[model samples]
Target chain A: MLADGLRRALTLLLRGDPEVLGIAALSIRVALVATLLACLIGVPIGFAIGTTRFRGRRTALTVLNTMLAFPTVLVGLLVWLLLARSGPLGGLGLLYTWWAIVLAEIVLAAPIAAALTAAAVQGIDPRVRRTALTLGAPAWRVHWVVAREVRFALLSAVVVSFGRVLAEVGAAMIVGGNIRHQTRTLTTAVALATSQGDFSLAIALGLVLLALALTVNVLLHMLQGRGDAGAA
Target chain B: MLALRDVTHEYLGRVVADIPALDLPAGTTTALVGPNGSGKSTVLRLLAAVEAPSRGVLELHGRAVRSSAERLHARRAVTLVEQHPLLFDMTVAANLTDALRLRGARRVDGRQISEALELVGAGSLAARPARALSGGEAQRVAIARALLLAPQVLLLDEPLSAADRAAREALGNVLAALRDRGTVVCLSSHVLEEAYRWSSRIFTLVDGRLEGMTPENLFRVDLPPGTGSREVRVGPLRFSIVTDRSGPAIIAVPPEDILVSRTPLDSSALNQFPGRLTAISEDGHGRIRLAVDVGVELITRITPASLSRLELQVGTGVVLSFKAVAVRVF
Candidate 1:
């Protein structure tokens, strides 16, 4: 049965089945948008929190670190309640739509980005900032020097966050509804297929998901290697 | 001139530097000579405007800087190379280019970057990555990065505290060039005689207090009106003076000027004292510092060879002699 499922999955992939390609494309697209939004909102927040000294910063970091380990299903359940009918945001009626799934993944990815970025910024040497200040750099330019010094680590944070959100199914399944040919992501389709005892399509979708995760990990290692070289 | 008036700074609620008045004039290479923890680096930071004074003013060209904008302007006019300088994560050439860009250079000239690196004998390391540099190479590159800005004042903290003989000679050439170029260089050093070779204006600091302008051996003397002899009593000894002012005065005998001998010699050179060597310590840079008491405490630095030749120890009684002309009154 496994061999037959694998052979059938490869054939479907090679034939470019519209259903399979559409699901894969939607998965990549939704996750890409979510990851970009997370980075846009989280990098600056993390940099500020990491560099500045203020009251309650320790509490903020503690909350952020806790959010990094929050269950994905819990994030999905919270989004479900917020988007459910008669909920606070129910007026928008975004439940079980592409936007709903994107929002869920965004909620999932942002904290990862923020927490890792803060760690990266904190790991750098303060002398780099002082040296730039002495070189006639204005405050903003000094900030740029610090960011540039840790650019590799920042990229690693982005990749790590992207990897986390891409592999997560609970949030997308709860918020996207797995609608046929519209919101059916690879993971949701695999779940739907496996429940009906269709192992071929489920295995095919699992293979695709595994390949993508492998790619993300490889990219992460490559980025870390370059960062170490630059810091050497 | 770059001036600091009533500028005092505190670190973590403890006073680290207190400068009543300091004037680092253009065309002068001033040296802040002191031992460890003497607040030399703190004074340099205040002069560079990188650290605001706890209660005082920093003046650029005789105008007091009052606001943040003016403080930034003051910082732009001066550049400081920290004692342990950190280079940006880039090639040597790129670091200089970034500094030029930081100073608002719209068009970064490659020739100018190369020239700055070459100025500090670091031209060969222009293409080398910053992380790959040795200690001396990194020091040279950091200084080169600062020199690229060509600010009116260049403050260096402990520039010679870590260099070897060859690096020292090369850095000496760089300092000599800056002196002739009239860039208003101010640096700190434990070795005073080396500072004298660069500039005459020296500010000595001891325990965070400005002890007039000498590396060591500063004495507050009372110059009472006397007969025809040009001499003043300090402690249990008398020293000849060149200045005619006859009131309380501060006198400094440069450490290099005093010659140590086993016994008093019959020579034309005038002032001499018999004293016991109280302490002996090494500055970790091939120089020995000695403290002696001839009814008053005095400090001097000499080489290892001289120490070995004189056979000096903690309790040895020796004679200290210097010409009357060597005593500086402030």
Candidate 2:
């Protein structure tokens, strides 16, 4: 039975089974969109909090750090509460839709991006700003130079957020409702397949995830090599 | 001209710098000579207008640099090179190009960048990555980057602290040329003679207060073991000091503290050296300066009346005397 399942998994992937290909495409597109949104909302906040000094800055950072370990199911519940028919934001009727799942994934991963971005900016050499300023750079240019200095760390924030989004199952299952062809992601499909004892499909989706992770790693390695060439 | 008026900066609730009316006029090199924690760097930062003063105003050409608009002008007019300047993670030429762009250069010519590099003795380093250079090489590039700006006021915190001989010579000449072009160059150093070599005016900062330590007759002395005897030997002469420090130290004998006489003094001035005068010139302060080769060269300031009374001339025998307390040991 195990050998038969392995052959079926390879056939599903090699022959590009329509269902498996659709699941993988939806998973990547959702994760990329959610990661982009998270970065857009988080990078500026992180950079500002990391570089400037003000009251309540530490409190804000503490809150971000706390959310780095946030439970994804809890994030799904929050999204459900907001998007459900009886909830405050339910007027748009987005519950059980892919948008609801994207919202859940964003809540799950935005904190990771934010906290890591703040850490990245703070890890930079403190003299970068002073050096840029001394060279007659304007305030905006100084901030740009500082951001450029930690671009690799910033990219790490995005990559980690994307990873979190791709690997999350509870949020996708809770809000996405595991509907086939519309909101079912690779993670949710794997969960459904295993529960129904469809070992071939489960193994096929798992292999796809592993391949995706490997591709991300290879790309990250190449970018890091370029970054090191630009830095020490 | 850059001036600080009633400027006081506090760090960690402690008043670290307090200056009431300090002026850095263009067309000269002024050195702030001091040790660590003396607030020289703080003063330089304020002068650069990059760091705002806690109280009072930083003025440029009699206008206050308080608002952001004025601050932009102040920053463009004055620039600072820190004790350990930072270089961007890029090629030397790229760094200089960025600096030139920030300097408001309409056309950032590649030739201009390399010429600035050549001025600071880093011409060959243009193609090299900044992180690959040695400490001295990095510093030369940093100075070149700053010099390319051509600001009216240039502040440097220990600009030559990590420089080599060739780098030092190149920077000195460039700074001299900048001064000639009416740039106000302010540099800080712990070495008084090195300050004298680079600056025409020296302001000594001690515990965050400025005292004019005339950059003359300062010498580095070595005290061997059992140095508690308060005596140091340099070359062929034994000098008396009032410090408990043993090993390498610096001592300064103020020119005005030395008394010149024709005969040996029977009084309590402990250090008396007999030597012939080498040169006589104006002290620039309504007095005359006499250089006497007393084992080590000693500079003495005397009034014209006293000079005539002693009939001192070049190559005449004279006795220079100062008390042990006159020697400042650091």
Candidate 3:
């Protein structure tokens, strides 16, 4: 079975199927855009959660952690409801578009990024932050210093979220409609290929997904190790 | 000059820190000594700008600041070092470079790094990967980094707990030099002896309240051995000393003044005890720490040659004797 799958996957890649290549490219573009958006929104929230001493901080943290476990299909369903015709955001006409998948992925990954960033910042010695503030690290710099100290963790969060976005099928299919050569990602491609009994194509997409995940994990593992060493 | 006016803090509606008023003048090393949970670290945190006083104003050079941003501007002039030296995962040189980056002293800072390292006697380990360095070495690197920042005020929280005697002494000198350079240094420690030795003025914290103690107060003990009309007991294993009179007393010795012998010495040393040895450990130098059991537990430091000659072990019985004159009556 493995030999047959590999042979068929190799044959599809050599053939350079437009649908396959287009879907892979689109997946990369959407996941990157979504991850960047998540970071921009997530880092500040993480910083706020990290340094603030207030009521409901714990509640806010608990909610974010709970959201981390929210399944992909659930996110897809919620976004589908909001962007589908006759829904609240239906007038925007984002349904069945690339942006719909991007929007859904952003929502999916934001909480993961935010919660991990918060954890990383919180792991820093409280005294270190105080020292930075006292030593003239403008309050903004205090946030930055603490954030930078946890940069590796934040990177890992992004990578983990990226991995989730790359592998996410339910949301991309529902929101993007798996549009031919327009919105189909590797995951959507894999699902369509399997449904059509094109097992070779599906296996190829799976290989690419596994490679991407491994690359991210390796890079982040190196960075996190260095950061931990520095911390020691 | 650092001044706190009626600073008060509460957590979950319970007051955890309260100080009526205090001034930490420039260029003096003030040691804040207290037991655990006494708010020593909290006071350092407040001064470090990691915390805000719930009800009081903190004035630095007679300025008023409201937000953490403003406080950070003030903090640039004061640098705080935590009890555990938080070293970055990098080369020692890189960590020192970050400290320089903060002060905008890029060119001349490298030389200052070496100077700071030399002051702490860890100059030889400059190029070492920081993670591979020992606890004491890492602390010295941290001190070097803090000094490179050259803040007008320095706050240290139990910074020498991991250091050996030589390193501690070296770091003590470095701090003294900083004091001489006119840096207002506030240091906290759980050990009173360290505070007594290094601080010209001492502030003690008890149950979240701050109180000042004079230099003499640290040394003030009831019935130190040398003073006239005082009596105390020194037990090697068993607490079997029958004093001339019983009252508040202390068994004081110069530590180095203790003489160890295999046989009962005929010396006129007034205090002596015969005890089985409990443990023998060296402080990595010529000196050895001997825990001997006489009437009561006693610690004796003797030369390595004597230790080897006597062949001390956990069950070895030896005579622990010290001179009365060496004991100073409080």
Candidate 4:
């Protein structure tokens, strides 16, 4: 039975089955949007935390680090409450949609993005800032220069955040409702097919998900290698 | 003038730098000479406005550098090159251009960038990646970046620490040229000869205190009671100066007044000793500086012609003579 399921799964993936392809595309689209949004919101915060000295900086970093490991289901539950009927944001009517999944994924990924970014910025040599400032660069430009210096680390943050949201099932299931041709992602489809004992579809979607992650990481590695060589 | 008034810097409750007062004027170069951990870099940082003094005030052009607006204004005219320079992870040309842009240059002239690199003897490194440059190359690049801004005041912390011989000579020429351009320059070095050669005025820091700027060899000597004149002993050598000052006092001897000879001379000079020539090096100019071990080491400056005429080389035995009146007791 297992052998038959494996053969059927391979055939489905090779044939580019519409249902499987749609789920994979939706998964990538949602994760990409979420990761982009997280980067936009998190990079500056991380830069400020990593480069400046202020009151309560340690506490802020601790909070960010703790948020990095927040359970995705809890994030989904919390986001669900915010978008539920009679909830404060219910008037927007975004629940049970791809937008809702995007929101949950952002919440799941932003902290990781921020914490990793902070670590990367902190890893840069402190003299870089001094040199920039001595050259008459303002405070903001100093941070910007430092960010450019550690571009490789920022790329890693993007890759890690994207992978986190792509493989997340509990949040997308809770908030996205797995609507056919809309909210159903590779991870959710895998969950739904396995529960119904459709092992062939489940295995096919799982393989695609793994392949997507591998492709993204491999591309990033190539880019990072190029950057390293150019720097050298 | 750039001045520090009652400045004291403390790091985590431990005092690191304490300067009662200092005045640095324009169109002159001052050297801060001291050993490691002697708070030389701290003084440079304070002058650069990279850090604020924990106590007292730092003034630039008669305005306090404590406020953000004042500091911003001061930074436009002041630049510092750190001991271990960190260049941006970009091409050397880009580093120069970036600094120019930050200094509010409307157009980053490639000619100017190349000239600045040439000034530091790193013109060939313009296309190389900054991160790939060696320590000496990066140091030159950092100096070039600072020079591109044309700051009115340049502060350097061991600028020649990593420079090669050629780069060091190039930098010395650059500094001399800057003086002619009316830029006030201050640099710190642990090498006393380098400091004495490069700076018209030298401030010696011992345990974070400025020991005044006197163009003389300084030796801390103990003065014990004597029958006629006060006898001051430094190492195995003793000199009787015409002074009544008791206890420990600093003795300053003018380097130019000290004469070196192959034989002991019959003269009125009160101080004479037989010593070995430990080292001979050129003082930035054509003059040669000899490190003679006369009980305590004494630095004597002479022309290269005299050095050759005297036939002095390393380890050559010589007689050093100086008049007691030439010694300034403080």
Candidate 5:
């Protein structure tokens, strides 16, 4: 039975099944949007925290680092409450929409982006900051120079956050409602297909998801290797 | 002039640097000579506006540099090159040009970049990746980057630490050129001879305190009570200084007045010691400074020809003679 399902899965994937394509496309779109938003909101905050010294900075950093390991289901529960009917944001009616899934993913991905970015920024040699400042670079320019110097690490943060958002299931299922053809992502579809005893569809979606992750990671690795070589 | 008034900097409630007063005049090179942990780099950073003193004020041209605006303005004119300068992850030319571009230079000509690099003897490294360059090469590029700005006050911390002998000499000449161009150049070095040779004035720091400023051999000696002349003993060696001051006093002997001979000299000079040559080093200007130890180490400068004429080597026996009048007691 497993062999038969595997065979049927490959055939469906090769035949360009519309439902499978739509789920995969939605997964990519949602993950990309969440990752982009996370980066936009996280990079600057991380950079500031990484470079500056102030009262409460240690506590702030500790909090951010702890957020990197936060459970996605908790994030989904929190976000779900915020957007659910009769919840504070019930007026928007976005509970079962793609935006709700993106929001949940963002809540899940932003901390990873922030924490990794902070680590990358802090990993830069302190001499780089001193040299730039001594050369009359203003504070903002110093940060910019440091960011460029650690671009490889920053790129890794983005890739890692994207992968996290793409692979996440609990948050998307809870907030997105897994509405077929509208908000169903690869991970949610695989879950629904398996529970419904549709082994062929489940196997097909799982293989496509794995392939997408492998391809993205491989491309990022190649880029990072090139960057390292160029730096060397 | 860059002046520090009642400056003290602390880190985590521990005092790191404290200078009651200091005046670094324009158009002169001053060397901050001390050992590690002596707060030399802290002084340079404070002067460069890379950091602010925990107390008191640092002023430039009679204006208090307290505000960020003032510090930013001063930073444009005063740049500090670190002990281990970090080159941006780019071509050496780009590193130099980036500094120029950051300083708001609209048109960065390649010739200007080349000229700056050539001045620091890093011309060949223009096309090379800065991160791939050797330590000495990176230091030279850093100096070139600083020089491109034509800053008014240039502070360097151990600029020659990573340089080879030839590069050290080249950098020394570049510093002289910078001083001649009326830039107030200050550098920190643990090499006393190099500091004495390169600086018009030298500030010695011991345990984060400014000890002295005379360009001479300084010795903390105790003097017995005397009226006109006092016998000062440093280690096992004794020297007479013509001073009315008694008790603990610092004595300085000008290197030029200290004469080295192969044999004991029968002369009117009041001080003489039979010592051995401990080390021979150049003063970056073709002159040699010989480290001789009788009971205490005394440095005497001579020409390279004289060094060879005397057949001096490490551990060679020599006699050092100096007159009491040449000793300045403070």
Candidate 6:
């Protein structure tokens, strides 16, 4: 079966299937939107967690930390329930749409961003905060300085979050329905190709996924190196 | 002026700081002296608004900071240079400009940055990354960051205490200049002599409670002959100036004022302690430092020849004597 699947994937790639290319492009577009949304929402939350010292801060921090390990299928299930027909957001008809896939991916990536950013901020000493405050930096300016200083970590967070969301199959397959020429993404495409015994197509998608993951990891490593150098 | 009216802070439900009505004068350097865990840092934090008072009220220029936002604004008027310089993970220029930016000073000139750096003798370090700085340089940068904001009050939580004498002296001069510029500088030091030299007023924290808010006054003790201060018995080795009045106090005695004798000798010096020798080490010069403990352990620097002539040992006994006149009760 594996040999037959490999032959099918090689032939599909040789044929240069437009449907496969479209699915790949749509996947990238959805993942980009989701990651961008996550960045917007998660950066500020991460900044708050990193810098604030309010009551229940620790509890809030712990919750975010715990959410970092949220399984993709569970996130997909939760989003499914929220956006499903007869669900709270059912009237939006977002299920199996690119928007629904994007929404699910955002949910998958946000906690990663928040958790990483929080750790980055917490790594900073209170003395720096005190220094910033005493320097007459208003609260907002204080947050900005902290965020800028921890930018490398934030970038690494974004990369890791993007990788996590892009590689998630359950959310995309469930929310996007792996629809052809519509909501299919890299992970869902690989799964569908594998199921259909289209091994060449699956192999090509697997390579892309591996490349995407590797690129994110390399970027993360570089950002981390810069962070260490800055700290040093 | 930063004033505290019975400011108290607790940690683990126990009182870490309990200052009773401290009125720190603006445009002068005051040193808070105490042993470890004595709430010295707590006092600075309160003035800086880093920590809220657990019970009593703290007023900056007669206004109470009621909320965190208010405190942030109040804190802007004051800068705290902590014991560990707390350098930001950014360029020196960025760290210096951070406060100005926070104040919304977008057009802050390079001249001002250079001026602040020069004030701290850190002009060359403007481009240096904060994390790459040595301990002393980082402290200077911290000071520069504080001063660039031109804060009304400067709280240094033993900023230079951990540094070498050269660094401490440089920092002291910078602080002295800040105080001269009408900035209220509050410095904490565990070393009394260093604190005495820099602070116009000296306050000592006793057992988590602040005491001795007296202006430094020079007092002389006259010792009788053959009564070397070294021979006098003391309960503890703690150098405590027993004073009658309070506002700020100072003790001044040259090393020459200390008269050491192997045997009990009569002298004009009134204070004497029977010190057990712990370590006899030589100061670079002709001076020798005898680590002695009578009631409290102390290090007394005497002449090298005197050390040898007396045959001082790690376990030997000696009489530590200093004239009452020599012991200036601040």
Question: Highest lDDT, which number?
Answer: 5
Predictions ranked by lDDT, top down? 5, 4, 2, 1, 6, 3
Please tell me how candidate 6 rates in CAPRI terms: acceptable
Quantify all predictions' global Cα lDDT against the true fold: 0.84, 0.85, 0.75, 0.85, 0.86, 0.76
lDDT of 2 by residue, A1-232 (tens): 7788889999999999999999999999989988899889888888988999999999999999888878888988888999989999999888888888888888878788888878988878878887777777778888888988988878878887888888899989999999998899999999999999999999999999988888777767776787777666
Tens-place lDDT per residue, model 3, B1-330, is: 887778898878877778887678876888887766778887887776567788888778877556766776767777777777766556788777766565455475478778877887878888887778888787777777777777888888887788887668877787778977899888887676788687777887765678532222122223333424344433222222223433443333444666888888898776777778888888566688887766655667878888888887789889888665655332
> TM-scores of all models?
0.78, 0.92, 0.74, 0.80, 0.81, 0.76
Off by more than 4 A, model 2? A224-231, B13-16, B102-107, B224-229, B278-288, B302-316
Q: Could you arrange the candidates by TM-score from highest to lowest?
A: 2, 5, 4, 1, 6, 3
Q: Which regions of candidate 1 fall more than 4 Å away from where they truly are?
A: B63-67, B218-330
- For every model in order, the fraction of real contacts preserved is 0.76, 0.57, 0.52, 0.67, 0.67, 0.83
Clashing residue pairs for model 2: none
lDDT of 4: 0.85
Clashing pairs in 4: none
Ranked by lDDT, the better of candidates 1 and 4 is: 4
* Candidate 1 similarity to native, TM-score: 0.78
Binned by DockQ into CAPRI classes (incorrect, acceptable, medium, high), candidate 1 is medium
User: How does chain B of model 5 score on TM-score?
Assistant: 0.69
Q: Residue A140 error for model 6, in Å?
A: 1.6
* lDDT at A197, model 6: 70
Per-residue C-alpha lDDT of model 1 across residues A1-232, encoded as one tens digit per residue: 9999999999888888888888889999888988999988888888988888899999989998898888888999999999999789999999988889888988888888888888988888877877877787888887888889899889998898788877888988998889987778888899999999888888888888999999999999999999998887
Which structure is stronger by DockQ: 1 or 6?
Answer: 1
Per-residue CA lDDT of model 2 for B290-322, tens digit only, reads: 999999999889999999999999999989899
Q: What are the per-model DockQ values?
A: 0.50, 0.56, 0.29, 0.43, 0.44, 0.46
lDDT: worst 10-residue window of model 6 chain B:
B215-224
> How many residue pairs clash (N, CA or C atoms closer than 3 angstroms) in each of the candidate models, in the order given?
0, 0, 27, 0, 0, 47
TM-score values for chain B across all models: 0.67, 0.89, 0.63, 0.69, 0.69, 0.66
- What is the Å distance of residue A23 in model 1 from its true position? 1.4
Alpha-carbon runs more than 4 Å astray in model 5: A223-232, B213-215, B218-330
